[model samples]
Target: MDMKKDYDLLRERAELLKVLGHPVRLCIVRGLLNEGEKNVGDMQECLEIPQSTVSQHLAILKSAGIIDNSRQKTENYYHISSPLAKELIEVLFK
Candidate 1:
């Protein structure tokens, strides 16, 4: 691969990681990974966090493309977008 492409990919990955650096976002990611797909209410119940706070963190994760959402009826469900999240979380636990 070209060096330029590698550099660009690294930069993009760095930005994604930076966006996920917050504790709240990390928690949201972890919750999604563990629970498979979850709505804001599920995250709030599992994480014991306020709905607004969880939504805020989820917004960051969504903006960063680290997670994706789908609407089911009136609820939006969230899940990890990449396998990198699983790898990162495993490393964090090690």
Candidate 2:
């Protein structure tokens, strides 16, 4: 086994876990998975958190490639983009 390759894979997985470890981020990810695609307004309302807070968590998830968004007119609808994240959320809720 190539130690460097293994280490790189571990690091990537660790980073994904770290990104999902936050309560707000976890909620956002889970919400996206369960509710399909949603915009900042929708998530803010569901989470009962400030729009800014939701956007901040979204930025983190987006940076980690855990979620991706599509633009429809004026709003951006976000959805889960990582299969690993989807499975993790399902296991967590189960």
Clash count list over all predictions: 0, 0
lDDT of 2 by residue, 1-94 (tens): 9999999999999999999999999999999988899999999999999999999999999999999999999999999999999999999999
Model 2 quality (TM-score) = 0.96
lDDT of 1 by residue, 13-63 (tens): 898779878888888887777668999998898789889988988888888
Instruction: Please give the lDDT score for candidate 1.
Output: 0.84
> Which residue pairs collide, candidate 1?
none
Q: Top TM-score: which candidate number?
A: 2
Residue 65 in candidate 1, Cα distance off native in Å: 0.9
Query: Which candidate comes out best when scored by lDDT?
Result: 2
How close to the true structure is residue 91 of candidate 1, measured as C-alpha lDDT? 77
Please give each candidate's TM-score: 0.82, 0.96
